[model samples]
Target: MNFVKRAGMSLGARKPRTAALLAIFVVLCTLLLGGFLLQSAAARQEADAQRTVGVDVTVRKKGLTPALADRIGAADPVHRYSPEVPVRAEARGFTPLVADVPAPEGDGAGQREQGPLAVTGVRDLGMLLPFSYGSTKTTEGRGITPEDAGRNVAVIEQRLAAGNHLGVGDTVHARSADGRREVALKIVGIFQDPRRDQPGWAPPHELPGNTLYVPVRTAQTLGTGPAKVTEAVYKVGSPDRAGQLHAAAERILGGGGFDFRVNDKAYRDQVRPVQRVGAFAGLIVWVITLAGALVLGLIVTLQIRERRAELGVLLSLGEKKWKLIGQHAVEVAAVALPAVALAALAGSLAGQHAGDALLGRQGDEPVTAAGAPDTVTAPPAVRVEPAAVGKVAGIGLGISLVSTVVPGLGILRLHPRSLLTDSE
Candidate 1:
């Protein structure tokens, strides 16, 4: 009769042994599929962390010009760059919030009594520390954007706006401390500051409410000499890319007084754990596949020993030795297909829960250490994909083939008479 038909009949006759093999296959396949799912999920989360919670590289020097800042910002690894220039201006018609304590008697005390407002020129207001940290928020109109680079505009604190009966679209005049240069800034936005005035002696400009954000050109106009930024900050996609940014900056700024500080504490606290999980999941996949193959190979070898008489009778009847191996391979494959299906079902049902258990659900607020700002990275969740199922199916087939074919090699050298004597 045909070997395929005989293989089917053999499986039907041995109900208990077939069920045991199916059970083992299901367990092995389920573990392998789970490992694949975890690996996929961890990789997705790591990418998200890299994109949103990357390292911040701060470049500080005495006089970092915007021209030099633009050159360094053009690097391939830098995502964005912000150049800040701080200048003092005395309010023309409105009073700024001041500390309650009396002014100290000193040589510069006369200038301290004036309490000029602190005007900060920025390429992008949203990238500033206070706004980025959520400590300050625009309550009316809009914050200064990159498009307002050369425009004369300002976004002032709401407290200063309300005290002076000012609102958006109103014009505010500011004169430089030297009284040589002045600017008429249109109030485009009003922001809210959570902090209050300090009790100890401090200048009016030092108060949070007296701060003003203006375009880089407007602040530069009030300065005496060449346009220069106080500091420049460049953002990179990940901690690893900080080196690339450093090299780029060196090409522009060179090895001078410019100091580069890289802050990657947030990346370390969040992204590193996800990376480790991905690596561990990959290791688990190889371990389970090798162990499953070894266990199944041993099982097949013992069954071949037990069926020596059956094999000898087949060989004596002029049956081909390759057909005997084919029958064994078919039997194992029959069990493997269903086990893969069962594993797919189980993975779809419990993949997310298992992932959450392994990689704990991350909080909305990124973990910050050593004064690092909170990042906006959202944690990724585990999901089932068709590709993962296909991988499990392929692996299952490989294990089945290796386990059956390696043990069947012993049958080729055995003679029919020797097999009959071994069975007797």
Candidate 2:
């Protein structure tokens, strides 16, 4: 009989063994393929989310100016760049509720409870905070525009505006906390802070409600130099580029008396957990795949022993050893084919649940070493795509081939007379 006929008769004669082997492959393939696909999808989603948040790094120097900001903005990796001039301003018309905390050294030799409102200026108002996109979304009239440069316009926090009974189009007079210099600013916008109260000790100037954002030129008037900036903030699409960004800044700004602080807190808080889920899924894939291979190998080994007489006859009839091996490989593959096909659907459903369980644990808030609470990143949405299906199918076929070929290789060494006598 031909190879195809031999393989079919072999499977038909051993229905129980064929069914048992097929069921085992179906279950193991379902787990291995599904777990692998889910892990891959989760990893992609996590990377996209991290890139959306963008890595943050601040450049500070005693004599740094907008020159550094300009050079960094021109860099290809930088998505956004802002030159910040942080100054203290005393509120004239109203006083927003300040958190009661012991202050540092002041004009009066004694420690003070409240400090002046923190007035921070930026070249681009859109790139305000480091948390993520829309962290400081405006809810009121409008944000500070490029045309508003040198126009003395400000965007105040919603809580500060409500506390001070201020609204859009109202002008507020603010005097420099240390000097006699003062400026009047028209309220242009009010933004709401999406960040929750984080646990940790924070300086008054770092408080969201205590900040007032203004244009670069307006804040420059409050400083000594025309381009004086206390902080130069830059955004990168990924954390791995932090060093690259720092190098670019140093190369362009000519590093001296400067400090570079890179913060990937958003990536750490959000993407790290999702990656962990993917890693766990990947580990399971390897374990299940290895176990499945061993189980299938044993089954093929036993089948080879039982079929030794049949192989001895085929070899004695002038059939090549490789053709005999191919016949066995084909028989096992035929049994595994349908099982692997059914596994595709089962794997998808099972993979989704496993992925969700892993990600759910990551959703819990992280405890900080410094007793400060931080925001937890939300899990990214995952979907098994057609590509994943194709990939899983490929992996299933590979598993089937490996399981049969390795154990069936011994068929080449079967002695015709010895196998025939042993079978009797």
Candidate 3:
């Protein structure tokens, strides 16, 4: 018979065995496809979140001098840095809509309880670090601009605005510790503070509301001259370079009596919980895939055993051992390739859904007018490039061949004469 006819005969003769092998291939393909999909989705989300939020490193001292900030920025290890002075101030005459509990009987009633507000005076507020969350959501008007610095213009928090019925173009009063020289500032913008939920504070909406943004120069005029920055934000080349930059920053600022840190570690810490889930899923996929491979090997081995007599007959008739092996390998590949293709399509859809679910759960606010509350949207379809599919096909074929060959070896070694003579 011709090679095609012989190969077809061999494959057709083992209907049950071929079916079993196909089933196992389907299972393995499913496992691998699912694993790859989930991993790809997670990696994409993490990368996107990192870029969007960026990172922040803080340095605390009695005060920061412009000279120090400039020196740190100039460091060879540093890429770009912004110096910010954070101060607590109270809005005078304007009581926050939220009320503080009355002081206990023994507490000094005369002492003025200061409402906390975070006043960040930066040189170029926009360039130092982009205000990502609150610009368009302004309840009344625009965000702080370079012109606002030293001109007594400030941006207040959203909760503060809600409580006080304050809006853009309204004037708010603030005073330093001396209280003798109070500054009346115009409210140009109202924003949502990203740090509202920081430690020692309740939820942003619940906290006795206090937050404001102003020009760096205006901050100095209000109280302490050229306020010291507690933290600095940097824009580096890439995530891979973050470590090198961190090391460089540490070396430059190590002994300067201030802490030098990177935003990556903090960000990773915050997302550790989600990462752990992804890791666990990967582990499960590995276990399942391995198990599927072993099971497939065993089924192929059994099929080969049942066909031992046929293999012996073929060997005696001058069928080459390599040819027989190749025939069986082609059969497995035929079964596996189709199954993998189907599984990959299904897995890609599932991955897209999973990614959307995760992002939705993360509660990302919508970029909308009137600051409409964010709603979860379905994630885009998972895209697998032609290159990636080719790689996966190669891997699947390799796996199918290896599983078949290793188990078929037992049947390939049978002596043709011995098998033909044995009458069962």
- Using TM-score, give the best candidate's number: 1
**Candidate 2: misplaced stretches above 4 Å?**
52-54, 87-118, 123-153, 157-160, 163-165, 168-188, 191-211, 217-225, 237-239, 361-378
Candidate 1 structure quality by residue, lDDT tens digits, 68-153: 88888889998766789888778887887766787677723665544368888887776665665567777788878778887899
Candidate 2, residues 1-424: lDDT per residue as tens digits?
Answer: 7887888988898899888878887887677666766687677667665555557788887878776677887887787667777766667777744444444455222212233577777766665553234445677767665567669988888888998889999998776655566789999888787654335534545667878888877776665335568787777877777788878877887846478888888768767777776888888888887887788778778878877888788878888887877787788678666876677767556655666666664544432111112345455445656676666556666766787788877776677888788899
Give the C-alpha miss distance for residue 30 in model 2, angstroms. Answer: 1.5
The local lDDT score (0 to 100) that residue 246 gets in candidate 2 is 77
Per-residue lDDT of model 3, residues 84-105, tens digit only: 7665555587764333444345
RMSD after Cα superposition, model 2: 6.8
Candidate 3 weakest ten by summed lDDT: 366-375
**TM-scores of the candidates in the order shown:** 0.86, 0.73, 0.66
